[model samples]
Target: MSWPHVIPYANPIYFLWLAVALLPMIFMLLIKGKRWGWYQSLITLIFLYISFGGKYWQQGLALIGYVIFQTLLVWCYHHYRQQKNASGIFYLAVALAILPLTLVKVIPFVDGGAAAIFGFLGISYLTFKSVQMIMEMRDGTIKEYHPLRYIQFLLFFPTISSGPIDRYRRFEKDLLEPPTREVYAGLLNRGIWSIFLGFFYKFILGYYFGQVWLPLLNKSLMHQGFFSWSLILYMYCYSMYLFFDFAGYSLFAVGVSNLMGYDTPKNFNKPFISDNIKEFWNRWHMTLSFWFRDFIYMRLMFTLIKKKVFKSRIVASNVGYFALFMIMGVWHGLTWYYLLYGFYHASLICLTDAWLRFKKKHKKQLPSNKFTKALAIFLTFQAVCFSFLIFSGVLDQLFFHH
Candidate 1:
């Protein structure tokens, strides 16, 4: 039997009604206790009742797999922490987890969805969430985990497909701890407003982009001489497109989580206004970059210094830049192109640092032309776009592989 035929009331609009109806109970249950065991049990039953229609067995088994893997990963990290105490081991562990999950995403035999990369349900979301968790663990910022909360953290329906990638420390405490009525009211309004914006972005703008621009890009894919320039120009537009699409997705996540009384992490911060590539990263996907900085970069930088590569400040800075971005690239995917993208960025960082060093060495002899400022902007943007060109995976498709 089909899902709709079997589940009777499983239509799309029914989901919105179910969500609106359940919101108050979820909020009350969340505010009631340290552990929402009762609430969770009830919800699991509801999921069982729906059962993906007759495919319930497969969905249940898939969930069981997630619990087993996620639990073991957390346990292993706990064991690692007891031994090393360095904390950066967390990002390394996260990267390791990504390898297996990436395999599971790409290699269909492992998790049954061989054709679709996102087959393991929330693989994309969990990958980013794993990064967030490991980052907090490394920073010594995460104090505890309630299994129920953690389960809900991963399975929160709104963000299960895509994400804002909330940090454990930021979410766990707020979730376990209750907020004041004023805080709840404010959060409610903010959540509603953000979700409203997200819907407009997704339904209105994203739909338009998919209908108009996406078809054009697909058609231009084969004969991309002029189209490549057009595609590159389109990417600047598509960058804006991606921003709204994903940011809209994030807002949708935050709003839904807020209604449940959980405070999610902020993911974006007016990225376009950023003056430099460094600042651009900070403002864009703010949560993910900070995860890299706190867990990956700081630990690697200090670890190198601890190992004596940092004896000279210049060598240490360059090494730090390269190592961090390398991990950044790897985090994006388990691909050679991602690795190259990492190196490309690392080289740019080295140039940026060296420029600062040279300027300090010859501060009195500097040029004072308006042209210099304009040139810097042009170069920095070009650098960002070129890096995008590499990671876009389009270049790999077109050039060397063929």
Candidate 2:
């Protein structure tokens, strides 16, 4: 397990080794109609070491500690949940689950901009898995807890660094029931296709946009004033780069999962063609948005409605949207741009909701046709790109820090 430090899915060498190592498991699944759980676990450790070893040994250690903390926390919560479902206990468990990630997000701001000692890559995503488990346990969605399965779910190597964020039950089913040979044939084909597509997206197009054009744009914009047309170009360029880079990583994760016989979810779905802000979320980063929608927005709305917090469901839902996105923004970081990015999206969603209601009320008055749909898409694209610009933090560099 001695190779130069490798980021997961970042280089061809990593994937080459991954494919070779996974050969045994793949063979067992395809030829013998069996899953070699022991072999799979061995390779999981090997890949984790390569990704977290060498210069990143500190992060490796941090990841180990984080996993242990989460495993124990979830186990204890599950134990208590069997006897009683207390709101205070559940809230405390959820908070504890997210505490490490919270420190990771907040510490840098207050600690002379130093990264938290306990911080590791994918802490936020791991925390999401942990907290979701606790919530579901409280709701009795998960009747029993299995520690090994939970750890495997959290540390599924393909998605360890970033995620399509598989749910416990969804993932557990794939583990409990190995895909039939016929079903696995489809998975294998799709898996290979996804990996090749990911290469095109991440290595080629992502490189051109993020590594090539973005720097060139920045250099040109530095010469021009902040309000120049080049800034708009930068916005669109950054947006494209962000999409390709992330979507490409996601494809690789899903592809690898499929190869291993797990039906990992897809993250992106041609997001730029969305009809509105809400639809954009449905397409883009589908897992994270869907996770937040299910675990945060829906829960908040339910709580509000249950307690009669607002007279109108619309107002309550709108408020829940703000809470959800604001939490999401903070999870990204405490920077002004990140905060504003969250606020901006929340505002757009609320406005979009209002317009939708208006459109429904005046269905005959408003035209619905291909031309109108195209117009909606075009406008939505511009708005989304602008939000990405804020997300890019160039404005903060140009205006505030300059």
Candidate 3:
């Protein structure tokens, strides 16, 4: 079968097709206060085919295998948890859920920098969802599993490629309960506005910053030394480009979900305005940060505390931060810069935590007015941008590769 393949929301043209495809569902939700499941499924398949079809068919096959693997894993775990729960089994289930993604991440490092056969875009996000399900199942929070609904949640095309990473329970709730007409109207309005904002961010600003000026800055920096003005400019420019590109994509995902009457979580919230590293993480990539906090950091802290591994809560928390960021860095890739990027953030967060504790102890003596807040924000922004410079892998290209 002949078909046009496009990455989700990669360009303006895709949005046109998206709008056309969504109109019928939009009407149905508005008029009936319910979704036409079969129709939604058909459109989802079409879009998935468009994204994973054509030259990307290998990734398509990989995705199918991944979905089946996760589905079966979760199913088995759910049944087992229902009968009886064991710590060993829960840990095994979580590990098995993450195994494919781990292989996909590790293979490139050992295989002469070749991509894994099983790797596909958004593998990390899907694995997160799968692992979350298994964990919740262990906790007895998720009592039942509907195979079809679970599949639909995984294949939800709007946020499939990259995500705001909707929670299973939240997504299931939306799936089961369509919004009322008044609420749907507000959602539609917000969705349209978000789409327009996404266009401005991704197409207009992102194109200028990333496609146009970034290369120019890089070319200039290449001829000059490391500490040149062009490099500094490139840092800020690249940071802006990264924010707009990722945030724009997130807005599109969220906007599309809203249009369909599902309230997926928001990803960004004035991240640049944050006064500290902790606040920045809270604002930027909100879903991912919260996921790491809930699934990794909190769990690790609990284990350490429960086992009496550390006497001090502060020390335990700091260790947890390091472990969490290191895993996150490795998740990004098994690369030097990515690893450094994770460590960099971990260090910043630890220092910020220390400062906050000190401030709390001496609240009366320490300044807490507008000037201090502005300075904190400025410092935090610069530190974050510097970390992004590392995350960009430009330093690796400049120093190591060259």
Candidate 4:
């Protein structure tokens, strides 16, 4: 038997089904001030089925196995962390947690563009959560292991595919305690507003910029060739398209989670208004950037400093930025463009750091003003748009495929 399938937030029609599925949960949360666990579980499974069932059954099977694998690994690590404080065991567990995702990412490159059998959408996000849990276990932050709850956190349909990446402990607390009536009323209001705003950003602006204007811009650019007026138009158009499309999806995830009384973290925060590349990262993809900062960069810096790997703190930090962004780039894909995009951002960030330091040293000489801040924002915006053009893979298409 065939089943209906839909990508989460892919179109307006999906929202109709989402509204139907979420209405009961929303009503219950509003009336009773508590969510029905079984009902929520049923909703999660139904959505999962819609997302990965039918022709995507293979992905569904992979998701099941992946969840079970991570759950068991986390359980074992939790037990070990309780009994022992060995770093090797913790590192091994973290590696094991990410191994499936690594294979999934690597397989397509080696197998002539064939996806890994164990691959599914959201594998990367799931791995991030699992690794986080294992790290917390190692640090004794996550004191106890509850397999069922852990699975629920991993399988939470909202923000599962792309994430604002909630911490396990935060999620657990929200799950255990529904918000107060007053708090829930505010949350419901915000949730409804976010959904409406998402429709405007996604269904309206995203469709106009991405589906409508992007193709026309691309066609114009092709005729005009590189470095033409059309190329400049394509750059800005693609950047806006990406922002609205992704920001819209994230708003939906957060809104839906809010309706269920879970306060999922917000992802975007007016990234284009940033004065520098460093600020842009803090605003854009806030969760992913913060994840790398917490899990990878911070830890790596600690290790380096502890071992005296670099005499200069500046050198150490610059190296850390490169490593962090490079890993992030490769995580996006194995493609050359993705790798270069990562390096490009890393370079910009490092340069921004250097400039900030120089300005600090020359405080009297370099005056800060509103006009300077505005200029900085404009320059940073252009730089970001160019990077997005690289990320769009248009260069690859223009050069390699042609």
Q: What TM-score does candidate 1 reach?
A: 0.76
lDDT of 3 by residue, 192-300 (tens): 8888898888888999999999999988988885878988999999999999999999999999999999988999999999999999999999999999999999999
Candidate 4 structure quality by residue, lDDT tens digits, 179-207: 98789889989988988898888889999
Per-residue lDDT of candidate 1, residues 64-124 (tens digit): 5665677567657866885786646766677675664667645654555652432344565
Please provide TM-scores, in order, for all candidate models, with all chains considered together. Answer: 0.76, 0.98, 0.98, 0.97
Q: List the residue pairs that clash in candidate 1.
A: 108-114
Runs of candidate 2 exceeding 4 Å displacement: 112-116
lDDT of candidates 1 onward, in order: 0.65, 0.91, 0.91, 0.91
- Please list the residue runs of candidate 1 whose C-alpha ends up more than 4 Å from where it truly belongs after superposition: 1-22, 25-60, 76-99, 105-119, 124-145, 224-229, 356-382, 400-402
Error in Å for residue 179 of model 1: 1.7
Q: State the TM-score for model 3.
A: 0.98
Better of 1 and 4 by lDDT: 4
